[model samples]
Target: MAAPVCLEYRIEGNDFMVAGAASNNIKNTLKMLGISSSVCTRVAIIAYEAEINLVIHGGGGVLKAEITEDRVKLTAEDEGPGIADIEKAMTEGFSTATEYAREMGFGAGMGLPNIKKNSDEFNIESEVGKGTRLYSTVFFNKQ
Candidate 1:
């Protein structure tokens, strides 16, 4: 594609029923664009994890995907209380998810790690009281 294609979605906190909608839509869009299955899967995982983060910890936020000829960039931004320690948050088993979220089978402390695993490049920034922003890129031809 010569011009980039962008998809954006507003996610609501604690909205379990629609939590995966944005990620599923992003995946389907990539598939329809003839992207490879592997790339699509990676992007889907990144998007899904990010989406869940928005719902469980973000208190509502925006999820965006920018598609280009060579890569897909996914971003999740939220205005909720941000992480005090990014390093700890990135650990596989560390989570700030509430008891309700765990009971609902949503939070397993693997969201950020999974997103990073499937992304070719990933970065996250946050302030304790301000918010969080996540940026991830998946190259179309990368394994």
Candidate 2:
């Protein structure tokens, strides 16, 4: 088995110009590592979605990716004004994105759902004034 690898990135709030940089970098790294295409695809989708969410809703946050021979784990943690209703936030087409966010071609409100859909396991925890943390994992074998 290969040794585990961890990659981290900071997502700056209100940054539309550079959003998805982390996810794209991770995807490229996974590809260079020769991870299976299916697994890479899943991870890319989830990572991109989560990264964009952080940019739009997270105030500011970190994106972490831990990769092992058998799994890839993704975690996104943000500070301030966390989700008031996670359930509602998870619903498709329900977005809190601003007018500028829409102009950026985002705010379709599919980020969380897509993240969940692409993850083999997923969990989310949040507090209104504290923060939100999303944990998700995809098993290599699941592909």
Candidate 3:
């Protein structure tokens, strides 16, 4: 395990073109840091999903990464019309994205599930009129 490293990224709302930039940068950083390939892959997937969610559902947000000896933590905070129904939003095929988002091939309603699947731990909080925040962690296994 290496020393703890912290990374942060700002996600622009409705920016489809740069939606995955933060995740890509994080992936590359992990690779350069010599993290395990499997770990990096999982992180990349979760990060990408979370990033897209920020762009699609968040209106705009920020992503924070904290790397420790045992795990990597990623948190995304966005300021958008909060999710009206958390339960419905979690459904596989449920989506409230605008036509433009859908046209961009995003908002398939799989982002949250995918992030949860790839992370060791996941938590989400949202306020109807405020915004949403997601916290995810991927633990590093001692081989």
Candidate 4:
């Protein structure tokens, strides 16, 4: 095994069309590096969900991915209005998305839950006016 590989990407707010680009890139990179298909799929799914959340919920954000020999770490940081009730937000049907977002078929409130489900570990922190940050880790063995 070698030292972990680090990758970083910037996600733009309200840019729905480009939302999944980062995750796609990460998937491709991992594939090129000969990562297992299962691990790559997990990473792609969670990363895509996180990226879309940044576009729809976050004003804009940065995504950092650290690929270690045994696991992958994903962190998303944004400057948008933070979640008011994280517990409720974590629920399946709770959402603060706008009508536009809803019309676009997003903001179904499944982003967080899906992220949590796909990751081995998940953590989220937010301030009403400041911003939000989410962290998730997926173990290769588990994949």
Q: Per-residue lDDT of 30-121 in model 2, one digit per residue for the tens? A: 88888899989999999999999888888779999999888999999999589899999999999989999999899998889999999999
- What CA root-mean-square deviation does each model show from the true structure? 1.7, 1.6, 1.4, 1.8
The segments of candidate 4 whose C-alpha lies over 4 angstroms from its true place after superposition are none
- Full candidate order by lDDT, most accurate first: 1, 2, 4, 3
Q: What is the lDDT of candidate 2?
A: 0.91
Q: Candidate 2: which pairs clash?
A: none
Candidate 3 ranges beyond 4 A from true positions: none
Of the pair 1 and 4, which is ahead by lDDT? 1
How well does candidate 2 match the true structure, expressed as C-alpha RMSD?
A: 1.6
lDDT (tens digit, per residue) of candidate 3 on 28-94? 9888878899999999999998888888878889999988877899999987888888888878878
In order, candidate lDDTs are 0.93, 0.91, 0.88, 0.89
How many angstroms is residue 60 displaced in model 2 relative to the true structure, after the best TM-score fit? 1.6
Task: State, as a TM-score between 0 and 1, how close model 3 is to the true structure.
Answer: 0.94
Best by TM-score: 1
Which parts of model 1 are misplaced by more than 4 Å?
none
What's model 4's overall lDDT?
A: 0.89
TM-score of each: 0.96, 0.95, 0.94, 0.93
- Candidate 4, residue 6: Cα displacement in angstroms equals 1.1
Error of 1 at 100 (Å): 0.9
Per residue, candidate 1 scores C-alpha lDDT tens digits across 9-84 of: 9999999888899999999999998899999999999999999999999998999999999899999999999999
